[model samples]
Target: MAVELALSADTVRMIVQKARAVSESLPDTYEDGHEGDLSFDTEKLENVHHHDGLAEEEHDDFSESELREIIDDLNVDEATELVAIAWIGRGDYDQGDLDLAFAEARERSTSPVSTYLLGLPLLPDYLEAGLEALNL
Candidate 1:
């Protein structure tokens, strides 16, 4: 699918790296027999969750310049989804909330990647709405 926003390769790489790091640190959601049974420490998870909450509070503090720099590197669709996921990670929303958002997106035939990413954390409703607005 064509990306609505235009992002630089480096920026995209950074976003992907961050997503991977977060995914790796999270507890395994698969069954016991799954090939990768990586699990996270409960204490670490708590700490990370707490920190992520704090990060959310600071999200809006990002200067217009900083926002532009980040947004400039992403396609409109990606940027829309990424920004929402970032807000969610920052503790703006909960998993159940994201579930509702995902359901809405699926009804609209949004990108799987966008759905997957948004489903991960506390993304804002606006981000999910943006995805729904996309041609995908």
Candidate 2:
């Protein structure tokens, strides 16, 4: 079955930055006036994997899958960025890895900002690269 992917790369990056900003702006939503609970889930990651070309890989990276799930399940648009952050938390890739991914993503599409942000500080250079790539 063909899946429909709705987010654009620019949109993804903006969403990610927005998500981070929101989190930082209100570290404790519960303490603040934000009514509602925020949590992460694994099923979302599975869905991301299924859509983000992970399902075709021969080797299974369950941890990445789980990370993708949590990111995908978030109530924010910056799911890719969150997923990248989770990868860093898992020690899956370094800054260089992120940079490489960003460069590759930039070459693949016009929306490098989102892909670069999605990769996050997996490589700090990605931020600059993403900005330069997107002309932002």
Candidate 3:
């Protein structure tokens, strides 16, 4: 019951859980300039790292695809709301400033929403905090 959001709080929670799984699966640090060089283990969202000498094409494997699919499945409004929640959670805006946050999220979402959101570390914590702040 996220009163201020377009999506259900439960739906947002599920999305955050999926995003957290994606974040937890990734390596702790990507080289600042070479952010594109990343890959993951064959299992679930865990043990991700750079495999030496792997081709760039090879790097776009399952874990990322799984995350993309998870986010891709959401309706446009839900996706937009999730981004807003993340922005609030990350302290980019006060809970009362949700309209501005939502506007920024939509304007900034030029890339695949999943790629953008998954790139954020601590997404789950941020989202959870935002939801609490909203008293969802």
Deviation (Å) of 101 in candidate 1: 6.8
Model 1 over residues 35-117: C-alpha lDDT tens digits? Answer: 22112222322222112122233233333234333333333333334544444444454443554433333343333333334
Q: Give the per-residue lDDT of model 2 (tens digit) for 9-34.
A: 44334333444443332323232432
The candidate that wins on lDDT is: 3
lDDT of 3 by residue, 30-80 (tens): 356332221222233223222222222233344657656655555566566
- Arranged by TM-score, best first: 3, 1, 2
Candidate 1 regions off by >4 Å? 1-13, 16-70, 99-136
Global lDDT of each model?
0.37, 0.36, 0.62
Better model by TM-score, 1 or 2?
1
Cα-lDDT of candidate 2: 0.36
- At residue 37, give the lDDT of candidate 3: 20
Q: Name every residue pair that clashes in candidate 3.
A: none
Residue 27 of model 3, lDDT score: 52
* Clashes per candidate, residues 3 or more apart or on different chains: 8, 6, 0
